[model samples]
Target: MAQPPSPHVERPGPAEVRDPLVLTELKRAGVWAGVVLAVLGVIYLAEPLLLIIGGLIFAVLLDGGARLIGRALPIPRGVRLVLVIFLCLGFFGWLFWYAGTTFAGQFEALRQTVEAQGAKLLGWAHTHGLVDEDRPQMVTQQLVGSVGRLTSALGSAIGVITSAVLILALGIFFASEPRLYHRGVAWMLPLRKRDFFYRLLERVGFNLRRLLFGRLLGMITEGLFTWAMLAAGGVPFAALLALITGSLAFIPNIGALISGALMVAVGFSAGTGTGVWAIIVYFAVHNIEGYVVMPYIARKTVDLAPAAVLAAQLIFGALFGFLGLLLADPILASLKVALEEWAGVDPHAEEGEEVASPE
Candidate 1:
């Protein structure tokens, strides 16, 4: 006898199954899109706040690492942190003292040179067709006027000193109690995702530290090498140029070009031979940096595309001025990491997938 007809089991309607999957995907996409828009909005609207907070966060993370190193070594964390801060303060103090002393000497020498040779130099330029007889005088007057205005502006900005002090105080406070903030952050997330969130924080902290240290190392090396070259070539104000170049190197592409241009100008001001030598030395140092220093330092830092960094700088600079340019790289790197993690992709993954052997 034939078995009774098999009991038919009904499947969910097409609408029922397709609707949930479609809804789930739309929801996921919507959440992510909202986050992206929110981040962009925050960056656009609150750039100054973002920059200050970012700087504080970076400082705290760096201090935290110093504390960790202190713990790992024989020194106490407090002692280590104190030493680190003192070293930093001492370095800046020494730099200012040196700059002031050198500037005083250079200023006197420069004044004597200008006074003694100003007319002769102007005549030479005019004779060589480099400038009209009146042009040199006009340019000199403009430069003097500009310098006076700059000095006046600086004198009027004494309040900036107080503001800087306040920022430093805030940074120190955060560095001392970073955990309190971290704990508060962790508390904001659901218990199930707290661990992941904490890990993300740690990753961000690590990346920021790497970027800071790498940039610092590269700047120092570049500055020192540039200074050595200038001094060897008998350039005036080698120390000052080195300091300027080093500080500017922290700014990436624009910084390098600006520093290079300044060096070349200083060279020309020194003399034709000096200018040529300076150009040679600049290129030599730059080559070493580009080939040797950057690659090595980058290995220890966050990997970011130069184009992306430049773009971010341009966008943020338009929105927030110089502060935005200073922070573009780190901000871009953080966003890059966040995007990679959110998309479940490895930022440093190999370009192609591996092939499987057929059985």
Candidate 2:
């Protein structure tokens, strides 16, 4: 009963999109696709990116030292930076000259000790019914294989040396004129966003410097305490253990576990008594650093949540390997600063500082 069949009209499908509303929807989908592709790209290029991050972290360390030197020296920035570099070089030179052969011997011993201890542990676990008896050897083999893979993931000895040199070079360049790089980065941003980016960068730099300073303090305290305590107790590998502990202390929870494991293993190489003492020393050193040194430092720096850092480390380490684990905390700290800035929080606000109340 319709008047004549309505004129046949072909309407555009979503795929043929002509309406502005449809165009907007298409743009949103395109953005999501681009984001996915970008993530894939990042995963593929993670190694070089991680190296860059490592360089930036090193730059932060150098810059922090330079600043500290500046406080008392009243010297030019470049001069202070140069002096810091020389001091570092001199320390390392002295260390090698003094203990090069000793360290070389201890390192071989340490490797053998760790492997023996690890095998013993697996055996103990199997005997205790913790690991399946049939698969005990398999588990140990897999553990060994995983370690091999981790080492290879970082590359061969030459490659590792090359990467370290590159990082150091990049750090020097970046620390030399950070502001230039800052401006260069900001120049790439949209005009409206540049201000925010600049502010975020400033906050990131400030937080990183403070974090590294606190970390340095912790490392020194832990190393000295461990060395002194272990020496007094006549623990085997006292010097070597202290060195490892101090270096690993730069890392957080995981580092402590690793160093403690190594220490205990080496300690047991001497005897059960020494091993017990090693365990005691581990707890005592960590407890003092955690409860005493770090808390005071945290009040003056960017205090990261332990869980947050651990989570980041696991994720990054899984995705990108060792370098990722090393840089995760710094990356997280940077992200934290950016988030706070995004949320309109004041970057310079002290913890527990009061906000003004309206009358």
Candidate 3:
């Protein structure tokens, strides 16, 4: 009775045949598609991404402060972090309270002085036949434009304040319990890759903390020395110039040039003697920091090539704006560390390794 017309009939499935074309082309195409999408996504989300990066950097700073305090206080990390935050806020408040109006006036004077100096420079160039008469005004305008572009990345005041607030808030949250976020990130990654990711993070934190500590030390020394020398030399806007120098030192190569130029310009606004003194002071401070201090710090931490750092700065500055420019070095350093780890090569090993033949 043929099982009385069974409720189900079985049918043979199709044979599992190999692909006519190899998977190599398909895989290459998929990878290219993925890369394209990622690039588009990054461009669209540049602002938020930059803010997040800023928060991370700031968090590292707060963490460093907390760790330092812990060495002395033996207090809870949360309390230490709060103390660090309050100290920073107090310093900023003091800075604004002390110099806000003075800085404003000095900044305007600085702009006028720079423009006037540029005009005089063009005149001299023209007189010496170094610049064509027709090009002088254009050159001056370009000079002014470049100066303006320094802060153009900051956008409007409201935007600046908003970004700062977000960064600070994010930094506080991240610093309060960085491990939670670290583990969260690891959880999303493959189990096999999680350990590697954590290792990379630990290495990154170590390098970043050292790098920033060295930077802060340099900033303080440079600023104080600059202010003292300029004030003694009777240079115009000594306080303002020192502040600029100190703040800009956070940036590496390009920043030094800008601060030096501004200092010299303001010095000239006072007199030729002061201008010469300014040049001397600029070189004296920077030469010591650049040739002595920073190299030692670089060796102790991550020693990135000067050319690589400048290139990263240019690219980041172009792509993401001022915050990007500011973050470029740290980001590059982090990337270098990550890549070295991924390649299974210890970045510092080569420097200290002893070469001994097998016995």
Candidate 4:
């Protein structure tokens, strides 16, 4: 009796106690998960919708500043919003028109260069023994075919007008009635959780807006610098190249390389001297961007880790394709905030103290 003193019992920690419930819910909601998967699958299938949603999200992030501007200015919010929208439309329209005109003017020159280079390239390959006598023609043909396919893909515009319209509509709705969405979200939660949920939404929205602004600033800088270099070096289609580079800048590492390589190729096609100059200019610009521009912009914007961003892009891109790629950072930022909050970690915790917990 005394020797068999009542064994001490220890209570499970909160997480340990919650595990079984979580597991049970997961098991019970396999059907719900399946439904979610089906819905996401359908969304992916409707690529245009996905793109429109993405564009709307981008617009919301970019135009959030319009609210502050409206408040501070003499103009009403609605008038300020209209002005921002008009400015955006006018800027993009001008870019499109300029790009179109530039491309059209350069098309014949590009075609001629490609034709001339195709023969010269094959001859050089043969002379340098890069290809066997029997394979030179086949290899050249393959190269040409590859280029043709790439050009076709790049030139094929898809749902631009429709996506623009939808994005504008969504942006207007979001700007006009953002509180409605916040209220709707808050209403979805219990009374006790509503405040927390609203805070989460606010954090998410802030992070998204910050990320967009940072990216926009970086892209503008990159595009302007690249355009200036190209123009100085007498590269054809400098404006178009800048536009393309700026657009692709949203894609991160791969985008920069692709855009830079294309610029070099365009330079090469222009002439040897021009090509050399373009290469030097681009290299210098990229170095400046990577070392100076990106770091500053990232500091000012969202404090996302590069690795986190890359990992998110990879995961989401795998799961949802292009839309997923576009939404990856925002999604990851949201998840990061949620994880931090759930783990009782401060959202504004110091960099060294930041800890990511298991989902």
Regarding lDDT, does 2 or 4 come out ahead? 2
Residue 45 C-alpha lDDT in model 3: 84
lDDT of model 4 at position 42: 66
Best by lDDT: 3
Candidate 4 residue lDDT tens string, 1-359 = 35754559676767673578888887779979999999887665656555555655755753676765766788766777777777777888897787677687675665566566566767788889987786767876886675454333123346446555776677777777778877986788788777667666666677677767767777898789888988988998787778778888787765677677767778888789998987897788778877887787666545677777788776666555555666677667667867666675764577667443323
TM-score of every candidate: 0.70, 0.87, 0.90, 0.73
Clashing pairs in model 4?
none
Output the TM-score of candidate 1.
0.70
Worst 10 residues of 1 by lDDT: 350-359
Better of 3 and 4 by lDDT: 3
Candidate 3: worst-modelled 10 consecutive residues by lDDT? 350-359
Report the C-alpha lDDT of model 2 over 101-127, residue by residue, as the tens digit. 678888888899888888888788988
| lDDT agreement with native, every candidate | 0.70, 0.83, 0.85, 0.71
Which regions of candidate 1 deviate over 4 angstroms?
1-51, 57-61, 64-68, 104-156, 159-163, 348-359
Q: What shift in Å separates residue 105 of candidate 3 from its native position after superposition? A: 1.8
Candidate 3: clashing pairs of residues: none
Q: State the displacement of the C-alpha of residue 292, model 2, in Å, after optimal TM-score superposition.
A: 1.4
In candidate 2, stretches whose alpha carbon ends up further than 4 angstroms from where it belongs are 1-18, 92-99, 132-135, 347-359
Per-residue CA lDDT of model 1 for 254-329, tens digit only, reads 6787678667766766888987987997788678877887777666656776777778877766565555667777
Q: How displaced is residue 95 in candidate 3, in Å?
A: 2.1
